[model samples]
Structure formats: structure tokens, C-alpha cells
Target chain A: MASKLGIIAGGGEFPGLVIAACRADGRPFHVLGLTGHADPKIIGDAPADWIRLGEAGTGFKLLKEAGVAEIVMIGPVRRPTLKELAPDWRTTKFFARVGLKALGDDGLLRAVAKEIESEGFTVVGIDSVLADCLAVAGPYGGLVPDDQAQSDILRAWEVAKGIGALDVGQAVVVQQGIVLGVEAVEGTDSLIRRCAELKREGPGGVLVKVRKPGQDRRLDLPTIGLATLREAAAAGLRGIVVQAGGALVLGREAIGAEADRLGLFVLGREDAC
Target chain B: MASKLGIIAGGGEFPGLVIAACRADGRPFHVLGLTGHADPKIIGDAPADWIRLGEAGTGFKLLKEAGVAEIVMIGPVRRPTLKELAPDWRTTKFFARVGLKALGDDGLLRAVAKEIESEGFTVVGIDSVLADCLAVAGPYGGLVPDDQAQSDILRAWEVAKGIGALDVGQAVVVQQGIVLGVEAVEGTDSLIRRCAELKREGPGGVLVKVRKPGQDRRLDLPTIGLATLREAAAAGLRGIVVQAGGALVLGREAIGAEADRLGLFVLGREDAC
Candidate 1:
């Protein structure tokens, strides 16, 4: 009998990838994909269950009923907006227990994970099954970082790490030892746009993204892809530095090609400095 | 003979207040206020020379030739867009020599100040002249922060100070120990508004603004006013914590009244934190 795996899909192609990787490993997988966040294509290709983002109680019940003893959470959920995701009685009770007045993305997610784990299922890191997707060290494509761009990358990397240490966020935009922006809950894409606005007439700066120190790799992994490359080019960014083996390279080949075309250096550095 | 002081005014009522304080002290004061940023009302009330923001080179020459040995940079200058500031030959030469790819607000101001000081004038802290305008420690109005809000304030304060240490602005918007945003060149009002967007439908969080660690208060002292109070209320913020003696309070009576009405806690903690 094959081992059955439970996957909590958020948004994006990550869910589909996780399913494919599990099947390739000959493991039977059950998925709980989020509505409006998970790719519809994932539903057709992967054998899985589904739930809306706010239906946490239903998700828990379904996972438990399926005899899911271990689970993995993956993909990006649409961020909880003020109108959407009014907590159900179970969730409200759970929140009451945590007692935080203003819960942010991390806080909310951690709370939900705790509630799910309380039901007896062990939550596992998504990377444990998809480790092959981790980015390698050094430049990804034909483009190489010049010494000047490399210096900016190192400086940005240091600042990004500091931000992570503070548990603020994992990314920072820097040029000439000055921070253009730091990623908070707003995420990297918006940060890139803001950096573009600040450096409107220049070649832009280096964007360094890394996993927070001691971050749970199962969730909150830094991710970059072709869309990221396109956005960086749009923002006039000269390059990007992501932590090697610490981030997911979604659409790695396409992103590399795009970076090469845009003359943007997309390098993965192993040292999480 | 009284010491004749030169005031380089920016925008806001700060210049007007400084002028009034100088007159009350019977000090000889002159102003070189920026056009498009400085209030025209300031020109009538303040006895000072006025000039456009980008015409700093000429302004410095005039102040130096007037035998002004000490200068105070005051008021809020509308941050100049790169296109708006048409740099003259001297400004271009200075930028070329500095080899800085991006000049943020602080960097630009520091460079201009360096040029002025090289010509023999000392840049004085605005606080040195208007000590009475400094905020006092403890709650100002009827609204004392609850324990939860106080914890949030302490958390936001530490993060704000860290941001200051980086010389990347001096304000942070935080909620439940999570930083919603860090002020860069965007300034505090916008920073508060951005945090509002991320708020999870609660009383909102605290806005913490402080003098940058080791900052030369001669330029860019943190400031709040009636407008700041209105912005905070609009952004759903519960309170504001500013570094006492390290920040300027404008429209104090009106601001206190509004804070009282809005149930917003406005406190100026001592700079020791």
C-alpha cells in the first residue's frame, strides 16, 4: 500500500507541481486546494479535495476524515482581505484562544496551522517532497553579475538578512549601500514597483530575497519566477540575489531566459548572509 | 551685536513658528525659503531671504556673503522629484564628484549642508532655537494606552529605532508585534496610509516616529501636528508614539483636542528607548 499524503494547496502552480512530484515518487497524494487561489488546471491534473480559503473548519474535517495523519501546506493563498474570510465559529474560537488583537499574515497562518495540528495531523515541509525545485548557487543563465552589481548584491544580502533576523520580511531592495525598500506584508512585487518609482531614471538596484533565519521551510519559502524577472525589468532592477537551496525557482528555465534577455543578473548565492 | 541667523525654510508652518520664536527672543533672523514648498504666509511673517528649492547653490552663496555664520534648516520641504530639481552646472559637478548613483532626501540634504559648511557656516539644529516646541514625555490628552496598545507601542518603537539606525527614514507602522510598513523616502503620512490598507479591521496599531540614532537633529527632526493626528485617525491608527525632545509638535492645542476626540493616544516618550 502506497503512503497517502495530504496537501493544502494555496494559489499558483506550486500545488500542481507538488502533486506531480508526489506521483512521480509513486506516493498517493490527496490535495485540499483553495478556491480562487489554486490553479484550476491543478484540479484536473491532480487527484485532490478542495476548499475555499476561509473554510478552515471544513478543511480540517475533510483532512481528518480522509485519515490524513500527515499533511503539507503549499502555494500562495489570496491574502485575507477585510471583506473576505470572516471567521467561522471554530476559527473565531481558535482566535479567541490566541488572543492577538491585530493578526497579520504570519500570525494568522501560524494560528491556522496550530489549530490544524491540534487535530492530530503532523504538518510537514513542502520542500521535503519537492527539494529538486530548490535553486542552485550562482547565475542561472548566460548573464553574469559584474563586480559593481555583485557588491550591491552582497550589501543588499546583508540588509535582507538583518530584516529577516527581525522577523520583519525576507527581501530588501538596495543600491549604493542605500535601501530603496524592504518587503513587509506587501510582498516583493509591490516592493519592486515602489523601488522603480524611487529610482525612476536609473538602472535600478539589486533585490535580495532570502529565507528568514530559522524559518519553517514547509511554509513561507521565498519564491521567484518569470513574472518576477518581468517585474524586475519593469522596475529597472539591474539584478536579483536569492538564497541558494533556500528558495523555490518557479518556472526556472523561463525565468533564466527572461533574465538573460533583460540583462538582469539572477544569481542564487548559497551563503545566507 | 546679536548673532544674525540664516534660516533655510522648507514647507509647513515650522518656518513661521521658528520666526516667531526668534522674534520673541529678539534674535536677528533671516530666511531663505524654498518656493513650491514653503508657505507664502511664511514670507510675510518671517524676515528672511527666499529662493527656490533647487537654487541651493545661489542661496548658500547669498547667505555666506551676508556674513551668516550659523544656519538652521527648517520646515518641511516638499520632497523634490528628480525631474523637478533641474541641477545647475555646480550641482551636476558635485554629483559627478560624489559618484553616488541615487541621492535620497537625507543624502541630498547632507551633501548640500557639506557644501555650505565648507564655505564656513555651521548648520545648527532647529531644536536649538525652538526648545519650547519639543514634545514632553507621557500621555498628552485623556487617552492613555491600554496594556495591549502599550506593548504594541514598545514593539513599534524598537523597530522604528532600528529603521532609524539604518538611516532609512524614522517611522514604522506596527500591529501586534508585526511591522506593517517602514518609512523610507515616502514620509510618515503616506506610511500611515499604507499601513491602513494592511489593517485587519481593528482599532489599528501604533505609529512610532523617532530621531534616527546618532542623527544630527540640525536637519530632519521628527515632527507631528494636527495634520498628523488627522492622518492617523483616517488610517485607523489607535495611537502615536514619538521620541520626546527629539521631535517637534506643531498645532499642539488643536492636535491634543483632536486626539482626545478620536480616542487616540498621543504620547512623547523620552528618547532613552
Candidate 2:
């Protein structure tokens, strides 16, 4: 009998990738794909079950019925517009009992994770299954960051880490040692685009994205891919720095090739700050 | 003899309004109007001298020539785009030596003020000449915020202050205890517009603008006007809260009338935080 695993899929290609990895490793898995964010094609390709983004109650029931003991959560869930995702009676009652104060990304995710575990299923980080996908240090692709770019990266690294430590956001855009923009709700791509528009009068800047210090890795891990690189190029960004061993690199080879083609530097550095 | 004041004008009606207030009080003033940002019509009407934004070094020379001993900076100078204003050798040297440490608006303006004062002129806050323009605590318009909106304002007040303390920015948009957005370099109007877009998926929010705790009141006092209220309406915001006794209110009558017409609440609170 095959060893069974449960996958809690959010948005993006991460869930499908994980499913493929598991299949190649001969590990049987059932997926709980979110309705709006998850790709419908994933259901056909991966061994899985599916549910809507806010169908947490039903998701729990299906997982229990599958007799799943261990579960791995993966993919990006479209951050619910909190008002639209009014919790069902069960979730509302749970929240009422807990009376949480903060509702930041981490706080909400941790609460949701706890609720999942409270239902008697183990919540595992995706890294447990795809450790190989974690980004490595040093330059990626043919274009290595120059000395000046490296200095900017270091400066931005410290600033970004300070922001993260404050529990704000994990990404900042810098050029010539001046911050062009900081990420809040708009996400990285939008921030990068705004930086580009703001810097239209000067040379484009660098994007530094890292996992927040003490960030719970089970949910909302720092992620980048070919699309990210493409957006950065479109936004006239010179390069990007991702925290080594702290981010997931999707389509690594393609991202590398694109960065080289665009004369963009992609570097992964250890969390120095 | 009337008290002689020097006004450093940026864009908008701020400089004109300041001049009107001074004139009404029988205070004689000369204005150094920023070319790109200040309306030429207002400059012609105001009792002052004029200069281009890029002519900062020469602007000081003109100010000295005007026999200006006490100077008041007012209005919004278009933040110079990197390409548009190449700081002359003196300005370049100043920036190079200053380096990349974060300087909040007050710090930057104060440093600039000191640079001017070092050349033998006192840079004064607008309050020195037009104290009556400062906003007071109370409803300035017909629509008063209800208890629910007031609670949201209070919640946003804390968040906005925290953000301001970080020296990131001065405004935040919140609704029902959820922060929809925080301003950082993007400025308030754009921030509100973004929040409005997000509100399509969530509860319409309230905007909170406040002075940073320990902020140098001599410079960077938060200000709002008719355009701000119009922007808030465009962004679907229901109300606005500004720091009482710390905020400058320009076009008060027009702004008040517009806010009343739109049924938008405009409240000013003491900057206790």
C-alpha cells in the first residue's frame, strides 16, 4: 500500500508542482484545492480533492473522511477580502472564543493553521516534501550582480529585514541607496511597477524580497518565479535579491534564462540581517 | 511698520492663502514661489518674490537680496524627480555626505532649513504667521461621523500613528478593524484611491492622517483641502480624521461645503498620540 499524504492547495502552480513531485516519488496524495485560486487543470493532473477558498469546514470533513493523518499546505491563496470571506458559523464561533487582536497576514494564517491542527490533522510545511526547491545562495543565471549592485542589495537587505522585524511587510525597492517604494497590500509586482514609474527619471532600481524574521513557514512563504522576473523586467528593475534558503523558486531554469536575457541580476543571499 | 515675513511657495493655493492671511492681519510678506508647482496667477496676486524649484542655490541668493530675515515655507513643491532636478555641485555634495539613513519629512525639511539658516536667514513654520489656519478639534462639516465610523477612525488612528512613527508615511485606510492600506512614498491621494479599489471587495473604509509622535512641528505639518475630500469621495471613503491643532486646513469653506454635500464626515482630533 502506498504511503498517503494530504495536500492543502491554495493558488498558483505550487500545488500542482508538489503533486507531481509526490507522484514521481511514488507517494499517494489527496489534494484540497481552493475554489477561486486553485487551477481547475490541477484537479485533472493531480491526485486530489477540491473545495472553495472559505470552505474550511467542508475541507476538514473531507480530509478526515480520507483518513489523512499528515497534511501539507501549499500554493498562494488569494488573500481574502476579509469582508467578503465572512466566516461561517463554525469559524465565527471559533474566532469569538479566541478573540484574536491582530489580523495581519501572519496572524490570520497562524490562526487558520491552528484550527486545522485542532481538527486532529498535522499541518506540515511544503518544504518537508520539496526540500530541493528551496533557493540556493550565489548568483542565478549568467548575469551576476556587480559590486555596486551587491552593496545596494546589502543595504536593502538590512532595511527590508528591519521592516519585517516590525511585522510590516517583507519587500522593499531601492535605487542608489534611496527607497523608492515599500510593499503593503499591493504585493511585490505592483510595488515594483510603482518604483519603476517613480524612477522614470533615473536608472531603475533593485527589488529585495525576503521572508520576515520568525515568519511561520507553513503558510505564505516567500515565492518567486518566471512571472516575477518578467514583471521586474517590465517595470525596468535592474535585479532582484531573494533570501537564500528562505524562498521558493518556481521554474528555476526559466527564471534564470529570462534574467540573463533581460540583463537582470538574480541573487540569493543568506539572511544577513 | 508691519512685520515682514518671507513665504517659500510651492504648488496650490497654500501660498496665496497664507499671503491673504498675513495681509489680512496687516503683516507684510515677500514670497519666493517655486516655478513648477506654484500657479503663476497666484504668484502674480501674492505679495512676494519668485524662483524656480531647481534654483535652490540661487533661491537663497534671491531671498537674501529681498532683505528677508524671517522665512516661512508653504505649499507643495513637486517632489523633484531624479532626472528633472540635478542637484548642483553644492546640493550634490550635501546629499553625498548625508548618506542613506532614513530622514522623515521633518528631518529632511529641517536639514534644508538649517542649510538656508547657515546662510543667514531664519526658516519659520507657517504657524508663526498664520496660526489661525490650524485645524481645531470638532466636526468642521455638516456630516458628523457615527459611532461605528468613529470607532474605525480610532482604530485607524493607532495604525496611522504606528506607521508615522516608523517615518514611513502619514496616512492609513482602515475599516471594521482591518487595515486596507498604508501610505509609503505614494502620498495620500493615491493611497486612498488604492483603498477605494480594494473596498469593492470589502467594507468601505475611513482615512486617518496624523502627525508623527515627536515630529518636528516646525516643518511637515499634515494638511488637507478640497482636493483631498474630492479624492476621498472618488475613493469611496466615508470619512477623514486629521490631527487637530497640528494640521493646516486650506480652502476650509469650500472643503467643508463639499464634504457636507457628499455626506462625508471630516473630524479633527487632538494630536495626543
Candidate 3:
């Protein structure tokens, strides 16, 4: 029998997807939902504990008492300030140990994962939990990218990688050889929405997402869902390109259908650097 | 006496500043203002020829007829589409010659400068004509950066240079070691304004601007003026940092006074990479 799982849920649909997957597999689990981040509706009727983001001690105690042996942290959480975070004793200790403020988002995640492991929980990656959710090589739907989009894909790939190497961002928008924007702390969705207004009067732009160089696979990998496709289409983007096997695609079928309906191509390339 | 200068004016106060400099020095010059870009008010009563941006052949002809022996291109023009440009026969020939669409903004500017030189006119950098406009090392006003602001400046400098190497952008906003935004096609002012919404709860961000690696100095170098200072202040940024001797600082005294009044530092760093 699969060990009881602990889900450390942040904002977005990924946590709900994981919960459904567990239910289908008959794997027992408990959720520790982050307040102000995770959707309370998603946790309805589930075995769960709710706590503020800075309440590390409470979260760990709740998971342990619930008899969880395995843990999976999922979804997006904007970086909060120290004032906003209001770290408790355990979180303060964790920050002291990790030098939290000096690290980027990925760095922070790696540290959190390490601390979770140190507490006797076997931390697992989302890819390992939901292997089917990983993006595959080539178009997700029936649409294929044309030469202009391919060129943009290649251009954005290099730029995204360049920024990623600096631990800056994982996504970029390019149109007709011009970079419309690069993702930073505001996240990919905001980046897309911002780039929409800056779009040139030519062929629409392409959104490219990739894993940061040397980034921990278990934490904060580039993720896109149906919402991403809809936003891209609404933002006048022609297509989406993500690194195959390096990013996540939640609700693939729905996303594929949505992409087709919006006339936006969703391609997964294996050539991301 | 200075050679009769040919000013290829785009949009912004840089053209006006250049024109003011010319009048102050009693230098004979003619302005070739781009129709959709330059301010008609700035070009008022000046020996100027108003033409569309795509009328390169006519521009050259007018300059030659006005006895222009030296040329300077200044100001920021949003990248326009070929359709929006409505390229005349000369621009079409120039694009065919230079592979225009394949180049970034700086690359296109270099090609234009080279073409102007080939047309028998000397292309001068803004630095050469307006030497006083060049940014000097250290603070521009009474305010000095705090340690945290200093750290943010260093972080944004590396990022700005990293993006610059990709020919992507010249500016980035960093707050508490997190990058808020990076400038792309939307320009520095837009980048600052966008980052304002993304500003974290702690100390404000710092705007770092640098010259692109291997970039031709004769073309677009990073430039900041009174408006830049106002926008950065309004965006809740702690300060602005520019590459010492590598960027233009227009209206220095007014900017310095404004910086002091707004409680923002405008530092020029000498060690930008």
C-alpha cells in the first residue's frame, strides 16, 4: 500500500489535481493548506490543516500527527516580505539556518524542501507523483508552429536560459525578433498580461518557458494550465513553447482543447538550454 | 566652427536638449524629424525637414542639400511594424541590404549609422556632442544609497548586463534581492511603471541601467532624464543606478534638485560589467 501522503498546498489548481490523483489511486493523504495562498474550496471535505505561511511549527506538527510519511509541495506562491510572512519560531529558525533573504525563489524552495526532509518526511517531486502531467516533445494539440514562431521560440529559449542562469526568470515573450518581456517576481501570468499591451503591430508573440539552469526539479518548475493558454490567446500570442520533460502541463486534455479553440499552438521542445 | 550637423530626431527630450545645445553654442544644424515620433513643438522654428521614419532616401537627400557634414541620431522610438512604417523604396532597399528584421534595436541602429557614414556624413555619438550629459561616478544629488539599496543596485547591475549581452534590454528593477522587472521592447519608463505594481512590502526597488556588451557607442546608450527620475520616484523605487561614463544624464542640475526633493538617490557606478 502507498504510504499516507502529505500535501503542502499553495495557490492554483495543481494541488486539487494531485488530490484527485491520490483519490483515484486509493492513496490516503492529508493537506496542509497555506492561508492566503491555497483555495479553501479545493480543500473542502478533505483531511486538512490550515495555517499561515509562517507557521512552520504548526504545519509540521499537523502533518506528523496526521500520520503522513511522504510529502509533496505544489503550486505557486508569490514571495512575501518579512513583514507579510511574520515568521514564527520555527520559520525564524529555518530562515536563520538558510539565510533566506539572500536566496531567490528557487533557492528558497530548495531550502524548504531540505528542511522538510530533515523532519523525517520523504519529499517527492510532482513529476514523480503525476508523471503524465509532464510536457512531452512536440505540439500538445493538432496545431504546429510556423517558421516565425519557431524562430521566436529559438530566440526566447536562449534569452529565457540566460535569465534563468542568473536565477532571474523562466519565461519570455518575443515577437518578430523583439523581446516583449521577461518574467521576474511578478510571475508568468502577469508577464504575459503585461506583454500584451506592449505587443508590436505585426505577427503575434510567442511565450517560451524553460527550467532554470541547475534548478531543483522538485520545486517551482515552470507550470502552465488552461488559464495560461487562455491568457496567451487573449494577449494576442500566437503560440506557447515549453521545455519538454522540464516543465509541467496541468490538465493536458482541457488545455489542448482550449489551445485549439483559441487558435494558439502549444509546443514542447526538447532543445531548451 | 562645428560642422553643419544633421539631427535625425526621434521622440523625447533628447532631441530638444540637442537642439538647445546647438542654439546655445551657435552651431549651424538642421533637424530631420520623424513624423510619428518627434514632437512638432520641439522642432518649431528650427531649420527642419519633417519626414516619415521610412523615408531614409529623402532624409539623406535633405541632409546633403542642407550642407550637413556630421550627423547625430537621438531619442527613443518604439519599434514600429513594417506595415506601420510603410517603408518607401529607399527603406525597402536598405532592409534588403542590411537584413533589418534579423537585428535587435541596437543592431538596426548600427546599420543605419553605417549607412549614413557610407552616404558621406560622419555619425557622431551623443557623448561627443553633449559631453556634459555623460553620467559621472557617484551620486548625482545630496542623497546616498543605503546598504540595502547598494546591494539591490549591485544585483540589478549584473542582471541588466546579463540581459544586455542577449541584446534584450538595458534596465532591471531589483528589490530585496528579487528582480521586479526587466526592460524589453516596452522601454525603461514602462519597466519602472510596471514594477511599481510588483513592488514588495519591504524596501523599494532600485533601477539599474547599463550599456549593452559590445554595443556601438554611437547608437543608443542608456539614457535617463528628469522624467526618468520622476517616474522612478513615483514607482516607489529607492534610487536609480546608471553605468558611470556609459549613460547620459540630461538636465543634471534639475534632476539633482528633484532627486533630493523626492528623497531618491541617483548614483552612477563605475564598476558596471
Q: DockQ values for all predictions?
A: 0.30, 0.36, 0.73
| Candidate 1 structure quality by residue, lDDT tens digits, A1-273 | 545788888776778887888778888778888877777786566767777665768888888777777788888764554345576666667767875443543555666677778888887877677776687888887887777677778767876776776667888887655677888777788889878877634445889899888676667688887778889988888888889888888767777788889889898899744
Candidate 2's error at B255, in angstroms?
3.9
Predicted model with the maximum DockQ: 3
Give the clash count for each candidate.
4, 4, 0
Sliding window of 10 residues with minimal summed lDDT for model 1 chain A: A99-108
Candidate 2 regions off by >4 Å? A1-3, A81-83, A100-105, A146-155, A162-168, B47-50, B81-83, B89-93, B96-106, B142-151, B200-202, B251-254
- In candidate 3 the C-alpha lDDT for residue A139 amounts to 85
What DockQ does candidate 3 score? Answer: 0.73
The TM-score, computed over Cα atoms with residue i paired to residue i, of candidate 3 is 0.97
State which candidate has the highest TM-score. 3
What lDDT is reached at residue B124 by model 2? 79
Candidate 2 chain B: 10-residue stretch with minimal lDDT:
B98-107
lDDT of 3 by residue, B150-261 (tens): 8888889998999999999999999988899988888898999989999988779999999898888777889999899999999999999988878999977887899999
TM-score of the first chain in candidate 2 relative to the native first chain = 0.90
Query: Candidate 3 chain A: worst 10 consecutive residues by lDDT?
Result: A98-107
Candidate 3 Cα errors over 4 Å, as ranges: A103-105, B103-105
RMSD (CA, Å), candidate 1 to true, equals 4.0
